[model samples]
Target: MNNTHLHLVVNHLPIIFPVVGIILLVIGIFTKTEVSKRNSYFIFILGALASIAAMATGEGAEEGVENLPGVAESLIETHEEAAELFAGLSYILGGISTVALFASFRNYIFSKIMPFTVVLFALATLFFAQKAGTTGGEIRHTEISSTGTSQIIGEDIKKESNHHDKE
Candidate 1:
């Protein structure tokens, strides 16, 4: 499949997988199950890898779509910025997940702290995830963008163009 196609398929994983992982982690914490914790860690790691894939394909996706009608560079820039934030947070989560996985295996003395730490990280990750998703959606979804909820950067050009057209 093309890079845009590949990106569409994998981009959601970073947004979705960590949510599932967070749930599993919470359950693991509540139930005191190493298996669940391990699984959560694995899921987070996968999410991180997927984030890399999505980031790698992003340029190709941009190249494929940036010139299309109604596709604003501002929207792309917004999405790109949000994506960078998401990716950085996701990588941190991945590192934490790996450490937590190992901690589960060895029953680390400070193991109790890891889950709480992950929970905090997940919350922040989730915030960025939502931002990325919304900005990315605005890239093409005019319905969402029409409400002036647009996070698109460089919007002045769009406004100026619209104003000129109306004259």
Candidate 2:
């Protein structure tokens, strides 16, 4: 119903996109199907565009939920930091995929380089996805909080804060 919700909805597509693209890419390579390769490239390009939208909405989502209970500013900051990196890579990869698609269309020099670029993009995407997932997990899992594992959220933050004050 808000930017956060919109971001969540859009964000999922990018995460799954690379996996699907990679599978298709591999299949395309094995089967020598230029059509498959082109389609897979198109999927990656779409995913990259979706990544941009997700990134745009992410800031608004952060603003909306920054003060929520069980949420920490530091945690959000950490997530944002990783998100910036992830989004940047996704954009760059998407751009490369777009160019490759154009080249493939022309029967141009892209055939030689496109495969390597796709593999690189897939690896980069996989890394970004991992970082994003970890940061997201930290949002609700106190044990994985960026500040420290022991800094619990929810009722635990209150109990621990109070206990520390008494000491």
Candidate 3:
């Protein structure tokens, strides 16, 4: 498939993975189950890997859509900036998760705290992910943008009033 198609397919993984990981990590913490926490680490690692793929395809995706009618360059730039931050954080989280996984195996003292640390970093990454996702959506789905939504609402109201006047 083309880069744009590839990007659309993989872009959600980085965003969705962290949410799943966070839930699994929280469950592990509450239940005192190492298995659940380890699974969460794996999910986070996958998310980091997916972020790399998403970033790799993003430029091509941008090129594919940039010239489309109603696509805003500013919105693409904003999405790119946000995606970079999110990907950076995802990499860091993945590295920490790798270390934490090894530490868990060896029963290292730091292992006990690493999960909590990873959770915090994952949360931060998720924040950037949300920003990136929203900006990306705004690039094509103008209905969700702040100004676009208001304009749509205004147009709908005008249409409704016109229909009533016609009746």
Candidate 4:
């Protein structure tokens, strides 16, 4: 498949994985379940790997779509910036998760606090993920764009009705 198709397929993983990880982490925290927390670390690592794929495909996808009708460069730039931040955070989270996993296994003193720390980092990553996702959506989905779809549709309807009245 083309880069755009590939990007579309893989891009959601980084976002979705962390969401699942966050939920698992919360449950782990509340129930004090080591298994749940460990699974969340694994999920975060997967998310970091997915972020690499997503970032790799993004440039090619941009080249494919940048000149398409109605696609805005500004939106692409915004999304790119946000995605960079998100990916960076994802990588850090993944590294920390790896360390946390190892520490948990060894019963390191820091292991006890790692889950809470990772939770904070994951939350920050999530914020950037939302920003990136929204900006990416705005690039193609005009309904969700900042321009406001109601105004666009209302103008179209007015023009159509006016033409009908004239005819």
TM-score of each: 0.87, 0.85, 0.88, 0.88
Q: Any residue pairs clashing in model 4, and if so which?
A: none
Q: Highest lDDT among the candidates is held by which one?
A: 4
Candidate 2 residue-wise lDDT, 1-167, digit = tens: 89988987887777788788888888888888888888888888887888888888989888888888777788888888887888787777788878878888888975867967786778877798779868966876767664545554346878888999999
C-alpha lDDT of all candidate models, in order: 0.89, 0.80, 0.91, 0.92
Error of 1 at 21 (Å): 0.3
- Sorted on lDDT, best first, the list reads 4, 3, 1, 2
The sequence of per-residue lDDT tens digits that candidate 3 reaches over residues 1-167 is 99999999999999999999999999998998999999999999999999999999999999999888666688899999999999999999989889988888899999999889999989988989999999889888877898656655777899899999999
C-alpha root-mean-square deviation, candidate 1: 4.4
- Candidate 4, residues 42-128, lDDT tens digits: the string is 999999999999999999999999998667687899899999999999999999999988998898999999999999999999999
Model 4 per-residue lDDT at 131: 95
Positional deviation of 55 in candidate 4, in angstroms? 0.3
Backbone clash pairs in model 1 (N, Cα, C under 3 Å; residues 3+ apart or in different chains), count:
0
**Residue pairs in steric clash, candidate 3?**
none
